[model samples]
Target: MKGLLFCVGLIMNCLFSTVSFAQTQNVSQQDALANTQKQLQINRYKYSTKAPKAIDGNSDFNSMDITSHGGDLAKLLGDNIYKVDSLVVRGTVDDVDFHTLWDASFNGKLSVINMENAEVKNGIIPEDAFWHSEQLNIEDGYITLIHLRRIILPNGIKRIEDAAFSYVVNLEDVNIPSELQYIGPSAFEQCENLKTDPLVFPEGFEKLDEAVFANCTNLTGKVVLPSTIKEIGEAAFWRAKISSINFPEGLEKIGDGAFYGCRLEEVHIPNSCKDLGIFAFKLNKELKEMHLPDGIERIPNNFADCCINLSHVNIPSSVKSIGKEAFQSCWCLNDVELPLGLESIDKDAFQSCYAFGQLVFPATLNFLGEECCTYLTGVKRIYSMASEPPACEVSTLNIGDTPFGGYDSPSTPNDIPVYVPVGAAEKYRKAWGWDYFTNFIETDDFPTAIHNININKPNAQNKVYDLNGSKVANPQKGQIYIINGKKRIFIN
Candidate 1:
């Protein structure tokens, strides 16, 4: 009887121990689930006034939104501000709120911001509102804000201060309010993904600040600036992918590198434009033609440098000086007429222009910089209207550094002829850098018209007219023709 009683007690004790172990595990799992649910919870705050009330639930939240009148978002969200991924601010916000939002984007999960219904005080998005701090990762000397993807600006905002959205690489969309009056320097610069097709500015904006859209590679298509735009600041559209742009009639100035490295095919500067900056249109590979207005005095430096496909240009009669490297490496430039009032051609202005078969220098020209006309392998003849040769640079280190130096190779014969005024051949032979030429011919044609024309050989019955409007079937050599009301010469 004693052994039976001991076995029953042992069995009861073992059963009790198993039940206690199971109960402990179930409680532990329930506690773990509750903690996970708390961690995943998201809290939203809506304030009707300037002062915010204490958050009711757990303080930790993954995201938050302030729907109404929040005084300062940073203080309202408190310690949980950095954990937010999406932010929505409506009604009224201040510069401090924008700064806090920028900080969250820089350090935390804040990515999307919606402020379409909100209004910022003073009608401005303050300077450096979204400019990432210098502590983040930088590429090519620019701080790229990779977190923020989208933002909606308030409707009544009038101005966006300097560097407001500069280097926001991942930004995809933003609304430009109609009431906007000014966009400060470096605004929207380097925003590679922001695609504003046919970029149109509001009517009230008068100026495009410096580097406003610089390095925006995806911004393409035609751009029509508003008539109120008076000036385009320096490097405003540098390295953009724009195919064409139209300048307003009242535009006064175009800053340096404003359209450099673009894909412009043609440009027509208006008569009101008085100033053009250096490298304004340089490295434009697709540019084929350009027409300078009558009032521009100087062609800025590197104006059309490396434009290999450029074939024609119209230099106005009022131009006084051609800047350095203005037309360098333009290999296909075959037709150009230098106006009578052109005075100076700067250094390397026409270097490597291989398609110029003939050149006529104006009478007023007095200065020619080093290598101004170097490497012109296709030049057949040159006419100088000036009685005195233009002053050419003489290099001590390289003999082939003058205006017309290296025009003929050592292996190829130096057969190109230079035509001068009736008594100017001896003077050219004695002039600096002009003495290198072996052949000089004097002529009375102070302003001879040399036209490049391709004529199809006519059949025997075709009518051809001479210079005096006389008909001739077979025009002889050195005879000038007036075919189609235009002067033509046949050299057989």
Candidate 2:
């Protein structure tokens, strides 16, 4: 009887212990759940209380200030996601959060995004992070657009990948981070309303990718580039409204159409620049003057084409060839001294330059392209320093279609005299393109007065006369003349 009673007591004790253990486990789980709920409520309150009130007291329009630790923001915001017009994101965020924000912007609900206090994952804004496409109509097709008006990038971001913020038409204010090192191609292209004045890049920034700021028509004022930049990619600042820009010293190359169609008034290329692509500064109607540094070997095609107001340019001696249409259609270009070492002038290099004075070709010149100097109606004389006439293409069989055809009226015979080296007039008369000219004057003391000049004495009483003995009304620089009956050069 005693043994049976002991067994029953032991069984009862085991059952009671099992029940107690189950109750403790349930209580722990319940406590954890309650704490989680409490924390969520606190976070919700934090967001709601700090969020800015809607403008003009419109309750329908709302701005939210949210702190995201990471992951999809849509899930964190819950149903309040649709009401955001402006957002201030803080704490940690990732690409998933950016995708949600992009959707909100595309719906025309979000306008301003400020993430200055946020920390992006990997310190990089990934490629097309906020890019989205929408189909508007059958005829219009798919297009990318966004309604973001202002964006303050996080301070820790180091790189922004290609097309990250492209086609953000309403974006006007952007606070670029100081830690930014690289911005990929077309990152901000077509952001027409972006008015960031005095656009300044960070100190360590290395390059500007292709079409980075292209078509930003309202981006005016001075542009400050960093010294560490090496290359400016193609069409980087095309069609911008910038008035002035300083090219840093370490810059090595300027890609094609880099500054094309801009409103730059003057440009001073640095000596460190060695390569220039076609149309580098073309179509700038407001450009009045430019200075090309010494290391550039060739002036790329259409370098300054159609610059109507360009009156002065100093071509360095390092230039070997002037590319096709390099300075074509510059109506106001009147003062240019071709360097002595220049070897080639490509097709239509200086065509339609109406205001050009006398042209002096260097002895190193070997080839002249078709119509290279056509339509220079104002030029009175051309001094060919080469004893051997440079090779030129005869455009047509008729002499009237020569490079110097438009210098004289079509009704009258071609009378523009070409001055050649001593005993070289006969050589020029037999040359293919030079034979088109009817008159050639030979001179023994041709270019000596141009190179050797004594300007040390005061020219208060000295009278200058041209080689033709015509009294000069205005004596221009780099011209050979008989000053006080002595052959001398005058340059000011």
Candidate 3:
């Protein structure tokens, strides 16, 4: 009986040990689950545009008992936004001990960090001595940057010193407090995909440092500039694929190619513009028309070249000069009305414009430069608003063979028609060489001759000449050649 009782006790002991082991395992799993819940439970709150609120100073953070109490979890949970309260000195400055505000993983990455009155504690590290941009930096190669999804910023965190958030690619979003004012350059340079959509700017921000978000190609969506900004630098948004932009009223100058090659269909030039630099819109073929403000004076050469769809344009009266070849190879251009205020026509200004069939001019026009209308051989009418008809070199052709493309007598005949000033036919006969036939039909007595010619569209036909001003071939296939290269012109 004693042996049997001892065996029973041993078996009971073994059962107790097994039961204890199972309970311990279950407890361990429960604790792990609780810890995970605290880490990931996100209260994703965003900053609102409320008025700035300042923090009060009363919490004694470095008390001996609480100093060793681990991360300041109670303080981190006190406010929705996290701002620097007061300096929480840990140990002696020389001890090289560092203290943390929030538990290193306390609120976890789930809560939006509102860093308002929160800052580096004293005794251990002061504000200015610590070049914060160099400190508190991150290094990551991936582009998601989703770590910053729930960060909160309280009002007291006034400034984001340089290099504050360098290369934290996992930072998905940013928390901005109203009290915060300034941001340094390259602060968020490579946060390529910080948000699911493009970032939206908060109001009250006046200045943006250079390259703040440079090379953020995946940051898609429209953004409006805050009116508080006055200047923008070059390559500010270079190679970015933004959709649309609306410039505020206070803008003065646009640094070189400030928004070059963006997919903007149209933009209004306010009166604030005084100058438009060269090639400002070189390859923006999508823009069909632009109306320059009256304040602008000069248009650079090839400023709007390669705009195949830019057909009709009316220069304002304020423009004084248009650069050479400004409208070269613009095949779609049809009608052009020169501004009466124009003073000069540069060489090749309107060359290769075969479509502009007419050029109406005021009597004030005095000069005709080289190749001004070289390829406009399709123009049939040259109407003038001046007191008298403008002179053409063709007057010499009819009066005598000397100016009929150098035909002295044989090629000259009654085939060409000449329009004269009322009774000036007799005078043109003597002074000009077109006095061959006895038919001198007066403009008023047109019915008498019954066969008068309108020099504008001379269906009667004129003698052809070679490049050397000698007759070569008859008119065929839109090309009329003359001997000695007598202006080989394209005829319609």
Candidate 4:
């Protein structure tokens, strides 16, 4: 009876212990599941404006989206997620991983991406952040950045800061929003392949700042300036291969070197452009014609230097001064009409211009600079409409510097004819430099005879004229002559 009772107690204790162990295991598993659920719930509630829940480890995706915070999308979208096609992250993205986005977007194969309201504290899009995207769109903010080939900007963007969209070689199409007001320096510089329609500034746009399109060698078509714009900053189109630009009627100023090294063929400055800075149209080799605006008071120094292909220009009556080296080395300039109000001509103003055939000086002119008309090999006649000779810079009996390829002697070539008014010949002959002009005729006798002066082609049968217009059989040293119908200014 005692043995039986002890066995029963041991069996009951064992059964009780087994039940307690099973109950403990079930409760522990329940706690673990509850904790995991709680953690997921906490994560879900973290974002204020959520798009969708993102799977942490999934490789293939059917347009799965998630809220990414503090640039963590770089790690979550692993290297194996090459199969994922589209990703649309919607949140306040203060930080981002460009490399990961580039790769996980399947080398920019993910067709559609919308990074809207990417809030940055300073309103600057960091350099090269969106470098490789073939197509992109930014909305709801202006974050200054560069390098997207094709982009559509948001309407709320008021400014594009300096160096934005620079060096993007493949950038072709840019949809500039209507509300954009300012474009800072070098905004689209070096975008070698960018081509756009006529860039007409919106009504309220005020300025196109410095170097806005410098070195954009492939940009074609015209640019239409807005009437409200007051300034075009320095080097705005330097080395830009643009063919045409339209200056609005009320445009105020064009800054220094604004259109230097361009292919602009012709320009018509409106009357409202009162200020023109130095070298404004320098090195425009294809610029064949231009007309200065009526309100311009001066042509600044080096204003049109090295414009080798320019042929015609019409100076308005309001211009009072021509600056130093203004038309220096213009080899193909053939014709220009000077206005009556001009008072001064600066040094080297028309140097090395071999094709200028005629010049008419107004009576109102008062000053001429050193070497003002040096090296013009083809200038055959000068018509001084002034009754009184303009006061020259030097007191010698020489006009300006000695003609190019001429000696420093006081004698001029004597081949160039100076025609004055009928009664003014004696006064010019008595003037200091005027006596050196060997050929002088009244205005009435000048035109017809001067135009008939023969330029003989040299052959065994032809005779060459020395610099003094004297016929010589053999080519002489230190003399320029007409050989084969071309003016040769030689000193041998």
Candidate 5:
């Protein structure tokens, strides 16, 4: 009986031990699950407050201690797994010191990152924190600063705030999200090394604030602007290496100095642009031709100023006035047809334009400001198409400097004749500015002829032609010419 009782006791003891072991295992798992739930609750509560939407898009969340517990909790939940909040990627995955899996994996790739549905709990990644990374993928996070080679922005991103990626030199490939509506001032300015094949903006894009891409020297090639854009802010592309751009139809205003000092060769100014700002296309020497929109009543000051290579410009009939220095220093401009309704030519309007050979004054012109044509040395004659000379005021020197370009030196007289209607000679000879010219001649009829003839054709026997290729049998004094294929010009 004692032996039997001892065996029963041993068996009972084993049963109790086994039962206790099972109970302990169950309790441990439950405790782990509770801990995981608690961790998740903590994480959610931590990041929910500083979210972009909750804060009205104020991206200043760098002080929060953001951490992820999703990965650890997934393991605890068994096959019904939850996504891991791969926290703070700082070092290689091989390093044991790094607490999170994301940090390990992110650091392992050195410069390439691929995070799926990740939220950056921290307000922003501080400027230049990842200078070594060549590419990045954090679509669902706010990024204020980084040093990356290529960027694939998230689809949920709406607005690129002020100077968000300014001066990110290595950034080459950029995927601007479709939802982006506004790009703040200086967003990508001074990024001298950034290069892209063609920068295409998304559909909802509305505004390009001041200096957005200013001083990006390496940003060459064409830009495809969308029709949804309404305004381009001041100095937007100042000093960029852009070669050409086509403004979309819906564009309303171009801010001042928007394209100053660029290498633009072709520009398509849409008629929708009613308010073209001053100095907008200044210092663009490569621009060869341009046509202003018809609705503009006055040419803005410094319009196309200093574009040395500009040869042809078609000003619409709607223009009533030419502003000061509007086409100053356009050295290669050979011809411009002014409208009959043009009322005024402001001071220095066509100063230093050396290639214009002649000018036809309009009938509606009432004011010709001083120094309007100060240095047009190539002009040989001036025609007052209007029977009456335009009204003008005397300069500070008391001498009317209206058509001042023809004067080379005081000793070398300005002999370029000013032609007027046969009966209007007396009226012009006494006019305030017109009387200043030394040679004023009366014409019976209008001389509306341009000299562009093929000299290759068998030289017309006994037919005299001027140096400008005009048939002039009665050669004028002090003008260079070809008398039947011979360089014999009279000095009077």
Candidate 6:
């Protein structure tokens, strides 16, 4: 009887131990499931903004979309990538994928792609059913939105292949089906030659790589530059002819000469510009006016060159240096307010300007380089910014319509117009023996040139071609030859 009872107790203990173990495992599993459910709920709430719409499981669509954030959709994609991956991705038509071939169908803007592997369909992959010889590469990364004028991505796309639209010139129009996000560099380097009309990007384009439209010369018309754009490559719009441009506020670095010779009218220099390259607007004569903001440090050479009709400008107090020959030969330039912070006025910067007068130099100027106002006889009264010209000759010879009618004063033509400061007209007349031109104006207006003295022999060598080949004036250094633009060079 005692042996039987001991055996029963052992059995009961064993049964109880088995039940406890089972209960513990069940509770642990329930807790794990609850945590997982909580995580999934949080993830769903987090990605509520980016979730895709519901669709039938067996729907036949060209492509599928994946969420950027973590959620049920992301989890499902991660779980069944190999199964639904083929349908989401497009296989290259040919085994040897030519990037240009892909880009020629899209207008660059595609870069991320999950192309099919080297799996066989019949004799080849189903996506590789190419009647043409073109191919999509397996190892290559190519993302093309619409290659040239050949391809059109009507259905929404999923991912991009890198460098896919590289150098596809024929691309004319682009209406990226809201699914695209990437664009690579040199994608449309020279595409303006392909289409005669201007190209417009879809509203969704937010990114751009370097040198995208480096030399699209014929790409005319204004474009609202993407606000998201940060950096632009040098000479990106090297020789384009967009009539007017107001760089959309977000652009930071304007790559060296990006719009070097572009036909821009008026540009309001944004504070975003930290460095403006030299000769950036060299020959853009149509750029009539500009307003520079607070941040510019140096005004590089030819920055306002050939802006023939540019009449008014207000140099900001922020400017420290006007680079060498920065505003050379802008003939029609009329008014300029030089800044107080300016330390130097580079050589011949305001040279040959007919209307630029009444300059008030700041007190801080110590280094006014030689020939800063060359051929600018219009300026007789330079209000000294503390330092006067060391030995500047304010004599009659240098205070007239012609600063270069000879240093000894003109023996002929006593009718030359002499303009001087309020009390300085007599100073010039007495110094240079120009008592004949004593009828000068001090405050305003010069003696009108009603009588036109057309010089008979300008070149002297080409006297026969008087009204045809050259100017009729004598070859004087400061005498504007044929109103300047018409070059009267004596071919030596």
What is the lDDT of every predicted structure here? Answer: 0.70, 0.73, 0.40, 0.60, 0.58, 0.44
lDDT tens per residue, model 1, 204-277:
77888766777677777777788888898766887777888888888898876778788888888888888787
CA lDDT of 398 in candidate 2? 43
The parts of candidate 4 lying over 4 Å away from their true place are: 1-148, 393-400, 403-414, 422-436, 443-492
Quality of model 4 by C-alpha lDDT: 0.60
Cα RMSD for candidates in order = 22.3, 21.4, 26.7, 25.9, 24.1, 24.4
What is the lDDT for 142 in model 4?
Answer: 20
Q: Which stretches of candidate 6 lie over 4 Å from their true place?
A: 1-185, 192-210, 377-381, 388-492
TM-score, ranked from best to worst: 2, 1, 5, 4, 6, 3
Residue 423 CA error for candidate 2 (Å)? 0.8
Candidate 2 C-alpha error for residue 190, in Å: 1.1
Candidate 5 accuracy as lDDT? 0.58
TM-score of each model, paired residue for residue: 0.75, 0.79, 0.40, 0.62, 0.62, 0.49
Candidate closer to the true structure by TM-score (higher is better), 2 or 5: 2
* Count of clashes in candidate 1: 0
Q: What is the lDDT of residue 212 in candidate 3?
A: 49
Off by over 4 Å in 5: 1-149, 169-173, 393-413, 444-492
Candidate 1: worst-modelled 10 consecutive residues by lDDT: 41-50
Highest TM-score: give the candidate number: 2
| Regions of model 3 farther than 4 Å from truth | 1-215, 275-282, 288-291, 300-314, 322-338, 342-492
- lDDT by residue (1-492, candidate 3, tens digit) is 111112222433421122221122234323422332222111121212112223354322221112222244444434422232232322222112211332211222222333333432221121211112222212321112222333444444445544344334445566554545565544554444555343444466555554344445554556566665455433244333455555565555443233434344455555565545333343345555555556566555444544445555656666666654456555556556566555555434565655655455443343433334445534443333323332323322134222222233422233333444465556545543233322433353211111222222113354555322345445554433432223334353
> In model 2, what lDDT does residue 128 have?
63
